[model samples]
Target chain A: MSAFWIATIGTSVIAFVLKYSGHSVPERWLSHPKIQRINALIPIALLSALVAVQSFSEKSQLMIDQRLVGLSVAMIALFLKAPFPLVVLSAAVSSAAVYHWL
Target chain B: MAFGAAAVANGFSVLQACLLSLLTFSGASQFAVVGVIGAGGSSISAIATASLLGTRNALYGVIMAPRLNVRGFKRVVAAQVTIDESTGVALGQEQRGIDAVKKGFWYTGIGVFVFWNLFTLAGALGAQAMGDIRAFGLDSAVPAAFLGLVWPRLTGKFERILAVSCALFAIAMTPILPAGLPIIATAFIAIVIGMKR
Candidate 1:
């Protein structure tokens, strides 16, 4: 099999392990303050990294473009506590509009 | 939902996209995988990054295990549907009772699972019909949606700073690192801060 398939299978397997381990493992082990703290912070950190890479980088190069505009608008909407769908729509529409102009 | 479209837009086959939604069932990690692959990154990196992102679900599983109390086939089914929406709904129903919590979990979990898969199929088909993803600027939707997802989570100064620093760090490392490693490296910030306290 190809690397792509290998990668996909590996990811699926690990993900299953992560999910399944929850049921199998003892709860006290996972409730440690440090583990809890890491869990809480990981989402914020990982999501932010995704936002940066997807918006600022294109094919591994940092390129400023309409995505930046869309991200800015979405960030503002999110700051205002806008609904998820609304924030996503505003970002898409704003980015599409900017892409049209450019 | 939107991820299915994004995956298709990234040049994945419809079957591949649906299989991802089916087998993986985690939206963010699935997106990360497709995003990495779309950018010509290696498969190993894609899997590693996605699994790192998915570690939280295991945390969620831990929280739900006692409350769920299933066995055999039901346990397997419960595990598959154990996601954010289900957990949130289950917790929300805590005021009612245990039965309510179970209902909430099962209903929300099954609901999202069915709808998510159906919509994923729709999105994949729609992307195929559209033919030109760039013209619609659908690419931007990925980051936009992710930003929206994380937006509410940044509830304090410390969290906000940590998020911004991670993003900047990933961007900075892009030039020096390989395709998918920079994102994986973002974990260091969380690790450092998490270990500090």
Candidate 2:
């Protein structure tokens, strides 16, 4: 068995706990408007932190490449409500093409 | 799921396929980790990258927690569903003022989880029969996933920063940093920045 499986499955149980444990608590404890607003913001912050990293960071030192161009186009496509597969597929095609030619 | 199939086709085992889905449970991370490990990268690197990919779930959980209000056995089920799509659906339903959004979370969670896990096996097996997964653009899958996630959250400049800052930083830093770590680093930085503000 590859190590990835060992890690993934084991983590799945742990991740499951982390994800679900929050809900079992009493609603009054969590339902406060302030808590609600904060609960709402937490994901936004976490997601922002996440996407920021994925879009730009590569193993190398701050290199912006064809992927960025593809990303911008993809974002635009998303803004246009182009649908899931299309946005990604178009970005991949354009990035690959851009890399091949430019 | 598709990634798992690809892994098996490319020489992974059934256990490997399932573990990747159950544990790593992320296509881009799984593929990258497997590719790196297959190519002789260190275990540390593979695990680190996989964990980084999984961090997005932290976002899903934080967002879904309120709506789910789930408890006990159902909480167990709901947690399994706390990925990008299910979370989005639940949040969207709430925005539309749908009642029982918590139920929607459960439904989407179970539905996507079952299909996604099954597809992991499919992808693993498919990879065995097919030569490669290029037709799927698995690498390109991450940003699309992010877009689906980030689009619904964008409401202001604050959110724009919250959403785009880490990605932009990661892009700026990816060329210099190690693979997968930059994203994690950006999240940490954002958290630190957010906490301070």
Candidate 3:
């Protein structure tokens, strides 16, 4: 599991930088609305990249897996404004049922 | 959460499973790595596989650094606690922040960290007795946890739309892509959408 730890440490350090960098480093706050808007996009940009990578890739293959299904169910739950716990449970149950059956 | 659940399902001893949680501390990474090793992959391959899936945590750091800049001992500890939920929560408070805004961030980040790991151990310990735990349908716990993390941040149409789109993208891609890459794609879509605006 050294790989796990390596990724953990590697990912943690980067996450720290992204999550805290704006507040941590004493960069002069930009007054430009455009710059502010662009900067604002950074977190969302990174978040999407991160989530997409995690959701789609696994074992270095490109097969549709249960995670995808579970995540889809999760999306539906969220759209319905289901409570967070319920969304999660629904996703898991749907994915598991689908995975087991198929 | 899924890591521990998968471990139990695969018949690992409680001790081994708990140790995975305590030490590995990575949900997807641990789950993916173990599956490979269990399938007879070499240590190197398993490690590489897990590392590949875990690359996002690093990006999390880059996103988190601005929100939490603790130094010295606390910095180190805070660094450890930085994960998906914590980083998102911390950053979500940026525009209309309050006194407890910082506290809210920390609560999300560190709180989830300690409890996730703790409950991970709890599940691992229950492995032996959790036979047929699938009946309880514990597999959904990770997604549930993700929802918990993402739910609180659903403030705007953009954020909500991004989240829903990504979730759907992840699910749709599940049958098409490899294991962990769906989330990556979803993340990319969100980023593009955010940048396009």
Candidate 4:
């Protein structure tokens, strides 16, 4: 199978296992304060990393371009508590303008 | 829909994107998969990052399991829909009693499932028709989506600081490490801080 297919299918299976395990496992195992705290932080860390990587990097090279504008606009929209779709749309619109015009 | 467009922009087939929504059903993890693979990362890296993001669903499962009290196939179905929205809606109906909780869970879970899948298909098809996705700035939309996901979760000073630090740390590591490794590495920072507290 192609790498994309492998990643797509592999991720789906792992995601299911994770969700199913939650229903089957004893509450105490995952409910510990430390474990909960770590679980909460995991997304925050990963998502933040994602934003940085997607915005500033281009395949192991740090390059700045239109994406930085997109990200900054996203942050501003987020600050104003714009709905999710609007925040994303504004960023895309702004960034696309930069990509085409500049 | 954003996922559909983003997945297409990231080189996934419409079928692949729809499959992800149908099976995985977790927004952040699904996004992580496309983001990692799109950036030229290996499948293993994509799976790891997606799984890490998925750990919370297990916690949601724990919260919903007893309340749901299902068995056999019903239990399986419950587990599949045990996401943040379902659990939150279920919990929010606490004062309304058990019947309301069950109703809330089912309605919200199934509702989101149907709409999310349909929109994903729509987004995928739409993106495919758009031809040059970069012209629409869909590439930037992916990161913006990530920002939107994490934005509401940063509810405190410590969390805000840690998230910013992790972002900076990942960017710093991006030049030195491979595509997905930098994101995975930031998990250690969170683990360390989480363990310290």
Q: All candidates' TM-scores?
A: 0.95, 0.66, 0.52, 0.98
Tell me the tens digit of each residue's lDDT in model 3 across A1-102: 544344334443443443334334344443345444543443343234334434444434434566677777877777788876577578768776876787
CAPRI quality of model 1: medium
Write down the C-alpha DockQ for each prediction: 0.69, 0.32, 0.20, 0.87
B49-166 per-residue lDDT for model 3 (tens digits): 4444444455455455555556777665565555556666766777776534467667886677677677666666654566664454554444344444445556688776766566
lDDT of each: 0.82, 0.57, 0.53, 0.92
Candidate 2 regions with alpha-carbon error over 4 angstroms? A1-3, A26-58, A61-66, A96-102, B1-75, B82-103, B124-137, B175-177
Alpha carbon deviation, residue B1, candidate 3 (Å): 6.8
**Which model scores highest in TM-score?**
4
**Residue range B1-197, candidate 1, lDDT tens digits:** 57778888877778888877887888778888887777667888889788887888888888888999988888877887887789889999999999999999999989988988998899888888887675666778788878876777798999999999999998998777887788878877787889997
Worst 10 residues of 4 chain B by lDDT: B75-84
DockQ of 4: 0.87
lDDT of 2: 0.57
lDDT for position B118 in model 2: 83
Of the two candidates 1 and 3, the one with more favorable DockQ, higher being better, is 1
Two-way TM-score contest, 2 vs 4, winner: 4
| Per-model B-chain TM-score | 0.95, 0.63, 0.60, 0.98
Clashes of 3: 73
lDDT of 2 by residue, A1-102 (tens): 456555455445545554554444444654455444444444454445444444443334344566666677778888898876577667666765666676
Q: Pick the candidate with the highest lDDT.
A: 4
